[model samples]
Target chain A: MTIEQGSYESPIDRSVFDQFAARLAGDLPRPTVVETMTALLRQEIIDGAYGPGTRLPEESLSKRFRISRHSLREAMRLLVHERLLVHETHRGVRVRTVDVHDLGEIFAARRVVECAAVERASDDGAALAVVRAAVREGQQAAEAGVWATVGTADLHFHQAITALAGSSHLDELMRRLLAELRLALHVLADPRRFHEPYLERNDEIATLLERGDRTAAASALRTCLDDAERQLTAAVAA
Target chain B: MTIEQGSYESPIDRSVFDQFAARLAGDLPRPTVVETMTALLRQEIIDGAYGPGTRLPEESLSKRFRISRHSLREAMRLLVHERLLVHETHRGVRVRTVDVHDLGEIFAARRVVECAAVERASDDGAALAVVRAAVREGQQAAEAGVWATVGTADLHFHQAITALAGSSHLDELMRRLLAELRLALHVLADPRRFHEPYLERNDEIATLLERGDRTAAASALRTCLDDAERQLTAAVAA
Candidate 1:
């Protein structure tokens, strides 16, 4: 049966689970099944293959993914906890819907964490080269009009800057925050309007860091964030 | 059957589902069973009621909490998402263990977010009074020698300050970071060491904010965080 028909008709099939398990053979290193499932779901969400508000039919997901009903449900629970998905009784799970307030929160958090990271990066042990490389990649992606690629690169550029703060906990927090923020970007109308200018500003911040001008680098990073926040607010509002 | 015995012998029972449904009757608002279970599990972890690295027997939790195996499993999935718990297929679930580096990362995040918040709280429109009230509560708790109470009050004081930054998102991020930090506190040898000094420092920062001295308040808050970080690091290292 086709995936959709199977989902509606029976929600479960023994062969689907068998295929899912078979598909997993040799595909991933011997990680736990839940981790493998999580990675797959994350990629699907990030790719916009699962549109916001559409229910992720558990049976279909299990059948197609070839994992047990138990493991797929567990993976869905993780996504829900991450705020990437929301689970409703009877209705099942759907990708979370992002609104204007969510955009503001995501960027506000980015400002607090990322700017501090940039300030920290200006010292001797900072990761200047990583930021520069990310910026270069962002510039290339922007020129190619691959807005999603450019957006990911821009996020990486900022993430690398934050990593200079030398706190893995902060890095992990920022990483989760960035993932949520990227979801909003998927629905944004003009992605280029948000990313193109950031490439040059990222370069400028890196240069300031290389010059050991922590204050200037931090100030520039703040301006960069404020500008992006304003643009995102306008885009999401529109 | 007694709770402990039932947990071991026939751990999955029909009444398990009934008890959860009854407790969630009309009064509490966020009505999802899985979410309620998640909150219960999170509280148990934070309170250190569940010993670290102890495998949470699913059947036992399901019976004791009087929740369906499916619902309990879903809640376990959320905790795993929060990194408060980890799940291994053959081994089942265990409370997550935080190391010295993890503790440092948690505090570093708090420092960045809280300092920014303090600066904002000193602004004209910010809610300084609310923060002052929470600080007073922390001081009172400390004076009473209620160290655990003081720890909780201290979290409230900082959360109130972060809320004054006028961003719900930042407040949520701060709350999560604080919860993770609390887990680290569970491992620390002397909880009183940090909370005792923090009560006084909270008052100092509050006074600075009341005077509308944003810079000084931010500076003082940073010092407070630095001191706490040092204590936590020392405890973890020891």
Candidate 2:
């Protein structure tokens, strides 16, 4: 179940959850110890370092992070709120597992959010540049045969699409949604097989945006996402 | 500025945040102490029991909730993630203040979510019934001159609009967005003057949904939301 890790293949210097927490909490002067821990665990979980349903023992995490029990508990609480982890009575915390139904709901949300974003995508050069950059990154990663990087780039691409809305709230929501999507993607048997086809579709959507055909872009993206959702749902169900 | 309090006027027996937390975390056997405290405080903040920017003293909340410092800290962290509270250095956690820009961003998100939901509203009678019931509740509350209830009903109505999409993710996202909007609405000098005009619009949108005029409903909602964003932004700026 090993997937991509490291900064070279990662899309951003900060984890998606960190960016989400920062935006969500508004501009904070500093990240607390708990926040730092939460971000690391979040990235690790999404990166498949901790597979779904793996228990994160409080004592072990406290030892690993060299943080207090209080701090680790706080970090776990934050991850629970983010839906990256779940806390069960007596059993402690475990990474959340997504099933077929969960995937359907996630894809339903992606369709609503990304479709709306592309339909109203901004004409601003900078926002469009982000969409373009993500597409290039995904393409390049695929060309290099780094499917893990390709997965990260795909998340980045969708995140950029929502970013075009210029709503911090939407960005925050999209971040969480994409993180959940990453979790769902883990069920795939072959990362490259799952992500390879979407690379060209991502490029097509980017091209449509660049040409200012937002409706067409949105339509194309919707069909593509539906197909992706069906694929993922079937994988999870199996 | 006391507005609404108590269960009769409140839209739900459980706070919106509790429902959101429960759904987001998936099914769990029981709610932790931290979860209980977070829900109560979240309701208080959204209901105007604690006004925006009001610092929630740790010692007092620890006393009031009669929970340990650790439990309180965990609860506060959850609220901060939900954007109901913000933690500042040395100053401690305070209710999040929504400024004019924040209101604009929030409204932008509402437009995206509600518009998308209504545009693809489910044909299921049960779903439409919730929308209709919320509409009636608002109308009745308005006629009874319970402006606070009217305000809550409005939140319920929009929530039901998103609920039509049948996505728990959107419902959770809408809960947070609407909570932020509630904070922004606190800026209005007169609650009646602020929410009165929208009651009829809610009914109109509900009617459109009931009749399966989804496109029209979505168009109307987008314009109404735009008008609302403009009005709220002006009020906050003033």
Candidate 3:
């Protein structure tokens, strides 16, 4: 059975997806209605507004989203392709569940990509700019006392780490991995309890890279993610 | 400037995408039209039918694919999102151009994910079976002298390796990265020259994993990818 509807916590609501979407959207021509709808639903799933194993009855969702059944199906189909949602004829559609084991695996995968990024991030000024901006954004969010905003910025920080590797393909892969990460971490009721401690570690990550001490920075990040995964895994277990 | 039309060599005509679609479509339910069309175009890109930097004129593609412009746009949007196609208001849409430097970054990313997958692949019988199947599939394709199919199977072999890690998220990331790898390798007219050498290495990788020698397997795959990258890079340079 599904958890009580009142218990759902969507990461999309915290503007993590929105801030990034707006930043990426940047008036990049006209977006099709289906494209817009798909992003919205994906954000909902990422936010944990819809938990895993919960059936997504299309008839009701289409009505609620005020889109035609055809367009809603397109959006749902896209998410299913992305593995955020899974479809089985017998089961219809349900959000993919992120479990405790998933948390550990995602952390491990993150270490592989993000650590490599830390060690090999481009020294080009443009690449460093992206990483620096992420740190600044996190700092500003912390100063504003918005822990959730800080959480979103923390997601950006890891993304910037991958950017250092300078492969669009790797960057895209990291984007999907991080999305799954936020989804898995959605289980924690108070995200502040999870993200608060990492703020300084993020700065240190940036500082190490800035000074070109990639070896130490990577070691720090590996330790940082290990601790984060352990804490989140414990939280998920509870 | 556009390359000569004679220079365009598409991968889809080999029906690489079609064979898989027909096989998978049986198990899966109705695919949305957009999903179907996206698959078709993506196959074309992978097959080198739509060579890099070639414009995808929407009106023409809609007519060619025998789908509505609306559905065709949806398909194009998906590919663009995948970086197989890029959208521009002025130039319209064109297949993404992968260059020499991209070749290096992709290989670096592959080494991180694939080597890590080697180290962490689960020892359970079923997991090994998946990796075993991919290797066998490649061997069969090579025996039949179907280099393209071998190329496709090679793609699956990496997928199986990642599956050994037992992280669905990692598997998904590997799938995307491998697609880019195939697309990058798409440029070589004689794929045989590129893929023929790797069949034995794949078996070695599977053997190492099956024997539970994760460390040696990881080291072997690292060298495997490094060598493959060098060969591909040299070919691209020519």
Best by DockQ: 2
Q: Which stretches of candidate 2 lie over 4 Å from their true place?
A: A1-31, B1-31
**Pairwise lDDT winner, candidates 1 and 2:** 2
**Native-referenced DockQ of model 3:** 0.35
lDDT by residue (A127-214, candidate 3, tens digit) is 8878889989988998898887898899998898888887766787778778877776767788777787888888888888889999
User: Which window of 10 residues has the lowest lDDT sum in candidate 3 chain B?
Assistant: B4-13
User: How high is each candidate's TM-score?
Assistant: 0.84, 0.87, 0.73
User: Candidate 2, residues B1-238: lDDT per residue as tens digits?
Assistant: 3422222122233344455557546665667777777777787788877666777777766755456878888889899988888887677888888887788788888988899899877798999999899989988998999998998999999899999888999999998898888887776788898889988898898888888999999999998889988888888787
On lDDT, the stronger of 1 and 3 is 3
* TM-score order of candidates, top first: 2, 1, 3
Instruction: Say which prediction, candidate 1 or candidate 3, comes out ahead on DockQ.
Output: 1
What class would a CAPRI assessor give candidate 2's docking? medium
Error of 1 at B184 (Å): 3.3
Of 1 and 2, the candidate ahead on DockQ is 2
* Cα lDDT tens digits for candidate 3, B1-238: 2442322332323254345457558866766556677887887787777766777776666655556777887687677767677777556788777667977877777777777667666668898888789888988998999998999998898888877767766677677677777767766778788888889998998888888899999898888888888888887676
Candidate 1 lDDT by residue in tens digits, B119-151? 655364447878888888888887788889989
lDDT of 1 by residue, A1-238 (tens): 0112112223445464344445666664466667667766776677776666667887777876567888888887888777888877777888876777887788777877777776655364437778888989988887788888998998898888888887776777778788887777766777777777787788888888888888898899989888877877776676
lDDT of 3 at B17: 38
Best by lDDT: 2
